[model samples]
Each structure stands twice: as structure tokens, then as C-alpha cells.
Target chain A: MWDGILTGLTTAVMPFNLLMVVVGCFAGTFIGMLPGLGPISAVALMIPITYGLDPASGIILMAGVYYGAVFGGSTSSILINAPGCASTVVTAFDGYPMAQQNKAGKALALAAYSSFTGGTIGAIILLFAAPALASVSLSFQSGDYFALMLLGLTAVAAFSGKGQVIKALLMTVFGLMIATVGTDITSGTTRFTFGSVDLIDGVSFLLLAMATFALTEVVMTVMRGQHNEQEPEMDMAALGSMKLSREEVKEVAPTIGRSSVFGFIVGVLPGAGATIASFLAYGLERNLASAKEKLKFGKGALRGLAAPESANNAASTGSFVPLLTLGIPGSGTTAIMLGALIAYGIQPGPRLFMDNPDVFWSVIISMYIGNLVLLILNLPLIPYISRLLAIPRPILIPLILFFSITGVYLVSFNTFDIQMMVLITVIAIFLKLLEFPMAPMLLGFILGGIMEKNLGRALTMTDGSFSFLWDRPLTLTITLIAVFVLLFPLLSAMIGKARTRGAEVAVNEGEG
Target chain B: MSITKDHIGGLVFLCLSVAYGYYAGQIPLLPGDEYEPFNAQSLPSALAIIGGVLSIALLVTADRSVEGRLKLAGYDFWLVAKLLLLVSLFAMALPWMGFTLSTILFLVGGYWLLGVRSIKTLLVASVPFAVVLWFLLSQLLDIYLAPGRFFTLMLGV
Candidate 1:
């Protein structure tokens, strides 16, 4: 493991590789400043560009985007008073008030430091955890794999959004259906191509990815109208010194440490990305705060800024655990990367550790470098980002369109794909209007092929006996977990209602 | 309370599931194969069943709302429609008119449609972008972008 770490650190410092990391972080932060666009969209949209580079360089770029967007999201939350993404929503809770009070520099500095700590800690946990987890997963067979993939899809669906289970599931199944197009390898027959010559190859992953993210985003932007909601006026003069006082650093240090562990744990869970991690960390901190600190939390408490800023960065690193060790992407942003890996022909599973350790380790090491680059960018460059927020809608929207169309064209050079993308974009916009969670759909599509393959293999081994899902202990354990996860929300709701009823009854009896 | 878009969406999906299931059932099996009931058709057919049931549940249990229709007007509907139509048109025309010419036409029309009134900005942004994209992707990356009849005839290739 130490040797692996050393190799990764060495690979990450190469000039070209290092350059890609810096560029990705800068671009991620810049794009994350856009109001409606977030890290997932940033990664998905940039994938075509990455296709032109080597896998390690491409991953280094995406990692930079992931962390950059997280940090940049806070920048938007602090400067403009509008949270750019869900992960940074909590940063705005205290971050905005500080900006209003002219303590913007202090808040930004705290957030940056917390982010660095959280990111470093999370990477450490992943460094130790991933190899161990990968070693364990090396024993996973077809059945175990299928069950894990099943759990991954179900957990993502459940966690995607509340009360939208039906919609998310529908989109998920729809995604799988879309994957059913073109050839079914075992049968040597086409399944759902509808007889078009272009359809023979099924749909390209690039085409669907561009449609769901890039095109849909554009269409939604247009539908959102030219009248974007006005952001709070930002004052350049109010950005105080970009230095953290010794006391301020001392106060947030414990909070950062606590949230780093908390956030990394949440992040390691399938489907719980940085947003959930940050929220969990913040909530835990707030719950434990004394009367003095509690009062100051939403009013610009140092710990308030530290908790989420650190945790989100930590969780961002945590999210990589499943993607590298198990080939299952727990969230939409990671799913985009799974597609990138497949495009490069590097199968991302336990075998990848042994087969492609260099690719995995280099990406891991580049993230540490990316965070350092971000911290440097955060301090001096942060105050100036408010100027970027003033960019006009007309100019920015057209540029987004240019990237979407051209990116799609550059991939396959087929006009049919471009046309198909437009049609899918229309559907995507329709789904967005309906408030269907697109992440589950994306996850489902990525996993659909693999799930089918594993299912076929597992069933073949068992001679089509479904009960063999319980034959192996590992597979059975995974199956149980999947079932438990599906039922958890329902069971929790029932228990909560029951507790409320019991409390009311006890109160009535006492009054009588 | 009354029917919302969920009900409409659910019904749309239900219909699709039924049609997909029907089509999946039509997939012929291999001759003389002694395999279990599960085959190429099995999983898809099962998914179709699951989808159909879920769609029905969505329709039956859809939250109550006054039946509402999606309505768009003025700069809202037509501009979006035109932009959608414009992209579709450009996509279709790209093969015939070529990447360079088609992009120029599309951007000019697209910017105009999106209400970018500055012709100078449109020309500056679209022309330079199209040329550079063509050069970088085609020449540098060794990617093949089809040159349409217009370009071929004009260049006398």
C-alpha cells in the first residue's frame, strides 16, 4: 500500500498530469459559479473533451472538477448569496450573513481551510479503505456482483429524492430499456433497435450523456426564460483580508476534524454524496453546540462554516470509494466517471486495482494536488469571482450551446447522433419539468449492461434457479442489505408515526 | 385536490410499458435450446411487467390536484419551440450543408432566436468558434467531419 501511494504521488507530479489537474480545478470552479449548473453537469459536459486525453490525465481533470466545483459552489454561496449547488446549500446558511457583515474574508478563509482538512482526511481514509475493500471485493462472484449492482441502483433511487420514488424508478427502468437497444450478445440478435441502420449499434453512451446533461441543461435554460432571478448585489470592498486569525483557526480545527470523519462515513455510503454528508455534519455540529455557539450558527459562527465546507470536500473523496473498488457509482457525478472509464476501456472493478493500479493511484494522488491548487486559487482569486458572476445571460447561454453541439459532433461525427440528441433533449426537458430525478436514470443506464451480464451469468451457473441468490453467503448478505435498504424509509416512517401516536395517548391518559 | 401531471405522465408510461412488453414477447427463441424460462425476452418482459405495475400505482395514487394543462405564451413558448426546431433543423441540415456552413447558419439563426440582437457579437462568437472547432477536431485530432456537396463543389475536390 505504501509503495502504491508512493507510485501515485510520483505519477501525479508529472508536468502534463499536474497541468491537467490545475486546469480541471479552475474550469470546475468557474462552471460551478453558474446558478443552475453543478459539479455533475460540469463533469458530464466535459467528458467529450477528456476523451481526447489519456485516462490518467482525464481522471485528474475530472477529480479537479469535482473538488473545484465543491469549493467554487461555496464561492457563489458566499459572494452572490445564492447557493449554486445542493452541497453548498449549508455553506450559504452562515456564509451569506458573513458576506453581508463584511466578514466575507474570514468566512471564505475558514471554508477553504476546512475544505483542505476534510479533503486530506477523506483521501487518507479512502487510501486505506479502498485497497482493503478492493481486496475483499476480489472474492465477489457473478451473483455477489449482481446483488451489489442491484443494491446500488435501488439505493440511488431511494436516496435521489423524497416522494419521487415512482418517478425515479420509472426513469431508471426507462434507462435500462434504452440500454436494451441494439445487439444482445448471447443470442446474437438485436432486441429493440426498430430496424434503423443507425440503430444497429444501439445508442452511443456519449449521445445519451450529452443529451441528458448538456442538451437538457440548454433547453431548461431557455425554458427558464431570459429573466433569471436577480442575485444579491456583491461589494468588492467588503471582502476583508484573506487571512484567518489564529483564534479562528483554533476554533474550527476540532469542528473540521469531527466533520471530516462524519462526512467521509456518509460519503462512503452509496448515493449519499457531498450534499448529504455536509448536511449530516452540520446537523451533528449544531446539535452538539452550546447555547453561545448555537445562537451564532446561522449568524456567521466559525464552526457553522467549518462543518459543511470540510465535510463536503471529505464526502467528495468518499464518493470515489465505491466507484474505484466496486464499479458501482453511488451518485450521478460518479456515474459520469464510470462512463469515462468504460470509454477508455478500463473496467472499473476490484480487478482494476491489480490490473490498472497506476490509473487508480494517479487519480487519487492528483486530487491532493488539485486541492492545493484550489486553496491557492481560493484566497486571492475569490474576491474577484464576483466580477465573473456579472456575465450576461445571452453570451453565456450561447457558449454553453456551442460546447454541447460541438462536443457531441466531435465524438462520433454522425449527423444521426446529433439529431437523436436533440430528440432526447426534448424528452429530458420534459422529464425535468415533471421533476423526475435524472441521476437514477443516468445510473441505471450505466449499470444496465453490467447487470444484465451478471444476471445472465449468475442464472446460468445456477441453471436458472433464483434461489441461488441465497446460496452464497456473500451474495445472500448483499441481497439482504438491498431488501433492507428498500424498506428502511417505509419502516422509519411507520415507526415515527407510531411513536407520535403513543406519545399522544400517554398525554391523554395523564390529563384524564 | 385534482389530477396533476403525474397522472398524465403515469398514463403515458403505462402505455409504453404495455407496448414494450408486447414487443418483447415477440422475440423468438433459439431452436433446440434447453434453457430455463428466462431468456433474452425474460428479463425485459419482467421489467415491462414491473414498469406497468408501477405506472398503474402512480396513476391510481397520483396526488390530488385540479387538472392542469402546461401552458406557454409570448417569449416563453415560441422561442423555446423555435430553438428546439432550429436545432433539429440544423442537425438534419448538417450532413447536407456541411459542418462549417451549417454551424454558421445555425448560430446566426440560434442567436437570433435566443434574442441575441447584437449581430457583431453573433458574428464574432459563431464564425471564429466554428473555424477553430473544425480545425482542432478534424485536423489536429484526426477526426473526420463530412464536407458537404457545397464545400466539395466550391473547393472543386
Candidate 2:
């Protein structure tokens, strides 16, 4: 482990890789500040650029972007009430109120400091947690892997918000259906080409990600007539002192610490990402607060701003745990990273720690450096970064659209790919209107091929029987867990219905 | 019953699953391959079944509130349709006009569609950005971006 850490340190400190981290942070910050684009879209936009680099540098750049986007999202949430992503929505509950109170500068500073501490704590935990988890996962067999993947898919659907579980599951199935479009590797036969040559290779991950996230998100903004809306005018002069008083610091200290740890645990859960963590952290802090403090939560209490700011950043780092260890993405952003790593011909899993120690360790090391860059560099430049948001929406919209389209086009240089992107973007827009979750579909798509491969191997070993699922105790445990996760939401919903019916019946009896 | 977004979504997916299952059956298997545990048709068949079941479950338990209905009003669907058409046109133009020219045209068209009518704003935004991007790909990266078919036919170079 020490040797691997040293190896990672060497690779991370290399001048070019360091440069990539800085550039990725800046780019991610800019993109993430834009309304309607989140870390997923920001990272997706970087895919074409990363393809030109080595796997280690590519992943390092992406890691920088991931947290940078999260940080940037907080910035937008504070300055304007328009959150750049869902995770930062909780930030706006108090952050915007602080901005309104002419303490925008102080709010921004507190956010950056909390985020820095949260991210550093997360990275420290990841340092110990990742390798240990990776070593344990090394024992995973084909049956175990199949079970793990099943758990991943089910957890994503179950965690999808109220009334969306069935929708999420159907979307997952849709993603799996899309995954079967190309040639079957085992048999070398085309399944859904419909006689088109472009369909022969199946859909490219880059195209799907770019289309679903980058292009569709930008187009959604235009569809809502946001393109015509005036750019937010920042009152730079009104931003007050950026420093936190000693009392303020002491007040938020425990809140930050608790939220950071809480956020990390939530983030490590597959499919529960920064968005949920930040909301939960804020709620937990509010619940724990005394009456007077609780009253100040929505009105810009220092602890109110601090809790979510720390949590989301910590959760961003924590999401990488499952991605780096079990090869299962903990969120939509990590799911895109999983796809990128696969594109690089590097399968990220337990083997990744041993097979590509530099890629593994360097990414971990760069994450710490990336957080430092956000604090030391990006925090001070928040005012200037917010100015980039002033670019006319009409002009900026086209440029982003151009990038999302050209990003995919440059890879294959295939005109058909561009057409395919438009088609997928249309489908994505339709799905978004129905309020279906996009992340689970993406996660399902990413894990589909691997899950199928593992299932096939396990089945063959068990002579066409499904008994391999239960033959190994480890596999059985994982399978049972998947079943429970899948059924938990349904069971809870049923119980709630029954309770409501009983209440209504008792009320009627009393009235009679 | 009045239809909601969930009802439409469920119906669409149910039809999709049925079609997918039909195609899964059409996937040809190698000789004696069916005897094996898994084949090309295995996952697809299972997915279709699961998809259909989930779609039915969604329809059965869908939210019936008025808020659940799909609202199309107030959306700029016309502008969105035009923008999508422009994207399709850009793809069609790529082989004919090449990367740089097509990019410039796309940006100009996008700006125009989004209500940027100033010729200077349009030109300034599109031209330099397109040329710089093209130069970065072709010169700095040494990528061979083809001159358009139109240029090839006309210039014979």
C-alpha cells in the first residue's frame, strides 16, 4: 500500500497531470455554473478531450471536474437562486438568503472552506477505505459479481424518489434493451441493427452520455425559453467581507464535521449521491438544532449554509468509493467516469488497484490536490468566475451546443453519429418530460454488458441452472440484499396505504 | 379514465417491450447454441419480460392527481423543433461543408434561431471560434479533418 501511494504521488505530481487537474477544475467550474448543466454534463463534455490523454491523466482531470462542478454549483446557488444542479438546491435554501443580506462574499468563503474541509476528510477516508474495500472485492467471483450488479441496478431504482421507482426500473430495463442493440460478443451475431451499418457496433457510450446529458440539458434550457432570459447581474460592490468571525467559525465547526461524515456514508451507498446527502445533512442539522437555531435555518444561519456545503463536496468524493472498488458507480457522475475508464480499455474494479496502481493511486492523490486548487485558487476567483455567466444566453447556448455536438463528432468523425445524437437527445427530452430519472438508465446501460457477461459465466458453471445464485454463500447474501432493496419501497408504500385506510375507517366508525 | 403522463409512458414502454420481445425471438442462434446456458437472446428476452411487467405495474399504481397530467402549454416547442431541425441539418452538412465551415454555419444558425440577429455578433461568435477549433484539431493535434466533398470535387487537390 505504501509503495502504491508513492507511485501515485509520483504520477500525480508530474507537471502535465497537474496541469490537467487545474484545467479540468476551471472548465468544470465554468460549465457547472451554467443552469441546467451538472457534473454529469460537465464531465461528459470533457470526454473527447480526455480521450487524447493517458488513462491516469484522463481520470485525474475528470476527478478534478467532478468536485469542481459541485463547488461551482454551490456558487450559482448562492449568488443567484438558480442552482446549477440538484445537489446545490439545498445550498440555496440559506445561501441565497445570505446573498440577499449583502454577505455574498462571506457566504461564498464559508462555502469554500466547508467544502475544502469536507473534501479533504473524504479523501483521507477514501485513502484507507478504498484499498481495503478493493482487497476484499478481489475475492468476488462471477456469481458474486452478477449479484453485485443486480444490487446496483435495484438500489438505483429504489433510491429514486417517491412515485418514480417503477419508472426508474422501466428506464433501467430500457437501458439494458439499448445495450443489446449491437452485435452479441459471445455469438458474434447482430441483434438489432435493422440492416443499418451504424448499428453494427451498438451505441457508443460517449454519444449516449453526451446526448442524454450535455445536449439534452442545453436544449431543455432553450425549450423552456431560458435562452431569452436576461443574464443575472451580480452586484459585485454589495459583496461584503469575505472573512468568517471567530464566533462564526466556532459555531459551524461541529455542524461541518458531522455533515462531512454523514455525507460520506450516504455517498458510499450506490445511487445515493451528493444531492441526497446534502439534503439529508441539512435536515439532520436542522433537526438537531435548538428552537432558536432551527428558526434561523432557512434565514441564513451560518450552520445552515455550512452543513450542505460540506456535505455535497464530501459526498462527491465518497461516490468514487464504489466506482474505484466494486466497479459499481455510486452516482450518475461516477457512472460516466466508469464509462470513460472502460473506453480507455481499463476495467475499473478490484483488479484496477493491482493492474493499474498508478491510475488508482494517482486519481486518489489528485483528488486532494484538486480540492486544494478549489480553495486556494477558485475561491478567490468566484467573483470573476461569476462574470462569465454574463455572456449573452443566445451566444453561450450555441457555443455549448456546438461543443456537445462536436465533442462526439471528433471521436468517430461519423456523420451518422451526429444524427444518432439528435435522435437520442429527442428521446431523452421526452423521458425528462415524463419525470423519469436519467441516472438509473445510464447506470443500467453501463453495468448491462458486464452483468450479462458475469451471469453467462456463472450460468455456464452451473450447467444452465440458476442455482449458482445461491450455491455460494457470498453470492446468496448479495442476491438476497438485492431482493430486499428492490422490494423495500413497495412494501413501505403498501404499509402506508393500509395505515391510511385504517385511519379513514376508524374516523367513519366514530362519525356513525 | 383521463390519461396522465404515467399512463402514456406506461403504454409506450409496454408496446416497446412487446416489439423488443418479438425481435429477441428473431435473433438467430448458432447450431446447438440453444442447449447452452446463455446466448444472444437470453438477456434481451428477460429484459423484455421484465420491462413489460414493470410497465404494467406502473400503469396499475400510477399517480392519478391532476398534477400528474402532461402539460405541453407554455413550452416553446416550435423553437425547439426548429433547433432540432438545425442540428439535423448540421449533421447533413458536415460531409458537404467540412468541419470548419459546417461549425461556423451551425453556430450562426443557432445564434439566429435564438434571436441573435446582429450580423457582427453572429460572425464574431462563429468564425474565429470555428477556425481556432479547426486549427487546434488539424495542426496542433495533427488530426486529418477532411476537406469537404464539395471542395474535393471542385479543387481537385
Name the best candidate (by lDDT). 2
Q: Could you tell me how far off, in angstroms, the CA of residue A342 lies in candidate 1 after the best superposition?
A: 0.8
Q: What are the per-candidate TM-scores when only chain A is compared? A: 0.96, 0.98
The DockQ-derived docking category for candidate 1 is: medium
Question: What are the clashing pairs of model 1?
Answer: B2-B64, B2-B65
Give candidate 2 misplaced runs (Cα > 4 Å). Answer: A506-512
Q: For each candidate, how many residue pairs have backbone atoms clashing (under 3 Å)?
A: 2, 0
Evaluate residue A184 in candidate 2 and report its C-alpha lDDT on the 0 to 100 scale: 92
RMSD of each: 2.4, 1.0
Give model 1's clash tally: 2
The number of clashing residue pairs in model 2 is: 0
Model 2 chain A weakest 10-residue run by lDDT: A229-238
